[model samples]
Target: MHISEGVLSGPVLLSGGALAAAGTAIGLKKLDYDRIARAGLLSAAFFVASLIHVPIGPSSVHLILSGIVGLMLGWGAFPAIVVALLLQGILFQFGGLTTLGVNTMIMAAPAVICFYLFGRLVHGRRAVALPAAFACGFVSILLGAVVAGAALMFTEENFLEVTLLIVSAHIPVMVIEGMITVFCVAFFRRVQPDLLPGARVADMAAPQERNEA
Candidate 1:
């Protein structure tokens, strides 16, 4: 979902960059210093995850485990995604710097939305959490594709073709991401349940609901 440097006009690029900066600021303010180390580790994991490419049909896709990041980190997914994408761009030239803001927003916004939605739906149900997490993972990837489509539409008349290409390419990757998120959430539940933010929220909410009842 990377838009090359010259694809976007100056106005769109500047506006996107400004919005991305604002979002990053908000993400940083919400970030806990205690969580910084963990977020960094997850960012590294995200970086590595995207490198393992799987060819699907006429295109290639890679594991994005964004749902796992969102589940664990909450709003912190923004900066984590930014950091990972920055590294990918600088080191691998996977994406260009000029379009970094757009790319980050495309991936991270859906993650934040999925985090909140999944957290709400899976409250108090560990059994349902994995499936919800998988759905969130799949949806986040689809949302990224939509964002890419929108961006392309604004700039190119033949954007539908590009959108279809992206969506088709990501289908297999989304499935992989979904399975990985489910397994990761389950494994963490078994090994270090406290590490998951959604679990903590559910734990806190349960007692209040019980007391009110």
Candidate 2:
């Protein structure tokens, strides 16, 4: 999902860089003090997960695990993902330094969106949470593909075919991520529910709800 260097125009790169900077600032501000340890762990998970990629045609699909990051860390995913991607870019050259901003946005923006959209459902109850977890995983990849594709199309009209092909290649990844998210969420929900953002919110709200009642 990384946009290679020199593919995007200066304006596109600048705008993406600006957006990523702003997002990273917000993410750092929003990081919970008590959850710092958990955030680091998730960051490590994200860093490792992307290493194993399945090359398909012109695009390579990998286990982003972005949904789990967002669902657990909220806006914190931006900073965490940035760190991981930075290391990946420097060490492995999976993506270039020039395209770091756009690549981070492509992956982390959808994660934040999923946190807002499906987070509550994932924390609601087991029956509802499983499906919501699945949806979060499924939708994040789809949204990331759309954003990346749109960015590419904006840079060059001729990239239409490549955009479509990349999007298509990730369809399998969407399903894989969904199933993985479900199992991961279920495990956390049972073993360490506090690690999840939704669970934290629900737990905090319970006191207020009970008092009001």
Candidate 3:
């Protein structure tokens, strides 16, 4: 959901930039040095995923694995997403520098929200984790669409139709993302259970301890 360079009004741009700045600070602080590698991989994944855009209206539809990033990286998703978005803007000219902050806020805010909302359940037992994973990915996109649409509408009255188009076009995308998240969650649970949201700091260490016992 890129807002382009000049589409947003001055106040709207300022609001997005301010909020994104705050989120980046918190994300940087919350991110541990140990997770730098994980963050990098996920950032690259998001960068690739968001590039395949299907034009809907003023915005476009794409596979944003925002929930997957949030589920794994927690608050780190904000900074992670920003870095990828920055490169996309600079190199590929996907969103542009001026709209970088807004696009980051649009994508990463919902990610953080889903992290808090579904993170625990996804880390829980099997019965709940699978469903939670699906919901996390599904709901994040829906919420992100809403925020993107609202951001556009707040800038001007004519974007009401565009806002509607954004939401409607993404409905299918939500389902696709939900399934992808579920598959990834399940695979990680089997191969690297500790990496999936339940554990962070001692993820690998915990498995070693159990094996040693």
Candidate 4:
């Protein structure tokens, strides 16, 4: 869902960039130094995962582990996603610098929302984590599609068609992302359970002291 440079008008682009900057600041403020390294590694993993594409009927789609990132890093996923997108743009031109803010917001907003809502959905049920994570991934892609559609609407008259196409292209990919998110969450549950934000926050004080020590 990378919007190319010049796709959005200057005003929209600047406004989006400002919002992205604010979000990045908020995310950075909430980041725990103890988890920053892990977050960076996971964000890089997520960036690479996007390269693995699957062919659908008319379009190709790739995995975006935004939900997994959200589940692990909470609000920190914003800056993590921003860093990944910036690197992707600089290194591979996967997205353009002018459109970076719009693209980052499209992906990162859903992640932040998912991080906030997943806790309510899962409550104290460990079994719900995988499903919640999968749903978050699905919703994130849909939100990204919506943002792309909105951007197109400002430039192209056939906004509905573009939106439909983007959403349709993501259907199969969403399933794949969901499955991957579920599996990743389950694996983390088994191995580094503390890596998840929920568990980490519950034990935050101890880790903070350990890191300071």
Best by lDDT: 2
The residue pairs that clash in candidate 4, if any, are: none
lDDT of each: 0.78, 0.86, 0.84, 0.78
The candidate with the higher TM-score, 2 or 4, is: 2
For candidate 1, the 10 contiguous residues with the lowest summed lDDT are: 119-128
- For model 3, the stretches where C-alpha displacement exceeds 4 angstroms are 49-61, 201-212
Q: Model 3: how far is 210 from its true place, Å?
A: 3.4
TM-score for each model: 0.85, 0.88, 0.87, 0.84
TM-score, model 1 to reference: 0.85
Put down candidate 2 lDDT per residue, 25-92, tens digits, no spaces.
Answer: 99999987876777888798778877778565687666888888888888999999899898887888
Please give the lDDT score for candidate 1.
0.78
lDDT of 3 by residue, 1-213 (tens): 577788899888889889999999999998788878878987887778766775555775667888988887778888998999888777877877777788888889989999999887876788999999999989989988898898899999899999999999889889878988999898988888766565664565788899999
How much does each candidate deviate from the true structure in C-alpha RMSD?
3.8, 3.6, 3.7, 4.1
Better model by lDDT, 2 or 3? 2
Task: Please report how far candidate 1 places residue 189 from its true position, in Å.
Answer: 1.3
